[model samples]
Target: MSKKAYPYVLIMPSVLFLLAFFVYPFLQVFAQAFTHSEGGLTIAHFETIFYDFNFLPSLKNTLLLALVVVPAQLCLAIGMALMISKMEKGRDTVLYVWTIPLGISDLAAGIIWLGLLDQNGFINSFLFHVGIIDEAQSWLNYQNPWAIFAAIVFAEIWRATAILLVILVSGIGLIPKEYYEAAEIFGANAWVRLWKVTLPLLRPSLQTALILRTLLAFEVFAVVMILGGSNMPVLMGEAYNWAFSYRDAGAAAAYAVVILVLSLLFTLFYLRVLRVPKEAQI
Candidate 1:
């Protein structure tokens, strides 16, 4: 090979790897969605997916979880980031403490919560021991899926909030002290300072964190499976059930396409609302 050609040869490997691993799979799924049985080319699978009873409900739940978790997490992350950034001592330790739960797998978090909230579980055992209830109340049962949803939300928030915190902290670091001091000198309280000074500057990071958290929440499966049960049925879980339990790849792929569309729409909506000026990919 020519001397100058060696660099192109070395870079070719990564380009090929991305095409083989990422581009190929995405293309295949998209292709499958268009080609179906009993029809050479059609939207049958999409129709079936949309018409399925659980499909709409699952989509609704997925959107609802994202709606609830994203704002709640962003708010909590902002507070934690502010607290961590403001502190002079133990700031490093607190940052690490926040990061510790990021290592927790979804399955592990689900199981831990299951243990705590199970009937005659730690929470109930304590309540019963303390005479808070006359009987062992089933905190997370089938009839009441909200409690299970709550557990899933808590587990998700506990495990995922740290990443958002880190994002905000990095944003906080990028902010100059002059803005904060100026706000203070103007007789602005903490809320006013946060809304008027801090949040506007934190926009890019907040936008990123929001998109990441919301997308992840849409694909919430492992935790829901482990804690909420397959019967409880979140969007991803229902997709998994269709794909694996019923061995329906066409439907599964269609569901995946639906999720992809929803995620993209959400991200675009957020970017538009935030008025992100550049189309920079992060």
Candidate 2:
């Protein structure tokens, strides 16, 4: 092959792989979402899900979860990354300990937290032993929506913040140390250096991390399923119910399309808001 064409040849496998796994399945879902069983194009499936009793609640929960979790995780991951970056000793050990949860599956993380947050679980036992409470409380009860919401949020943050941490650490590492030295020469403190140098340079990574975490948060299922059960209505859980419980493939596809569209919109928003200038390229 000619030199000019070799790069294309190298990427042909990846392009083909994406077309087969992503583009093909996306088109299939899009078709399924728009078609009726009788072989007619219809909006009935969209209407069905839109009118379902769980639809609005699930939508609200999903949006709320993403909004709450993404920002919190970003803040935490940034803090952790910053701390790790400043460490001269045991940095690798600390990072490895923090990221251990990243190796765990969503369902496994949910179950681990379930054992801690269950009514007669470790949390209650600990509190009882310490006399913090007189008896075990129903922490995951449906009647206590906030408690359930908090549990799911806590589990999600603990399990996923490591992803953002790794990204930010890599971004921070890319920044030249001379920037910090220059800031120090100008009487800038650690805080000023962070805001003026680190964060400005970290925009690309922040954008990528936020876009990824936001998309995953939108599609969160297993953690909510285990912690909140049907009491917590999330978009993915509703999609699962439509597909399996209600046996409505069209409705399920509609939900999947909605999720894909939302993820795309958020990706665009992040790219726009965090656009790195040509002159600012690091």
Q: Which candidate has the top score in lDDT?
A: 2
Task: Please report, as a residue range, the 10-residue window in candidate 2 with the lowest summed lDDT.
Answer: 136-145
Give the count of colliding residue pairs in each prediction: 0, 0
Q: Write the per-residue lDDT of candidate 2 for residues 1-282, one digit (tens) a residue.
A: 699999999999999999999999999999999999898899999999999999999999999999999999999999999999989999999999999999999999999999999988999999999999999988888799999999999999999999999999999989989999999999999989989888989999999999989999999999999999999999999999999999999999999988999899999999999999989798
Off by over 4 Å in 1: 1-18, 276-282
Worst 10 residues of 1 by lDDT: 273-282
Q: Return the lDDT, model 1, position 242.
A: 78
Model 1 lDDT, full chain set: 0.84
Model 2 vs. true fold: TM: 0.97
Q: What is the TM-score of each candidate against the true structure?
A: 0.89, 0.97
Q: Which residue pairs does candidate 1 place in steric collision?
A: none
TM-score, candidate number 1 = 0.89
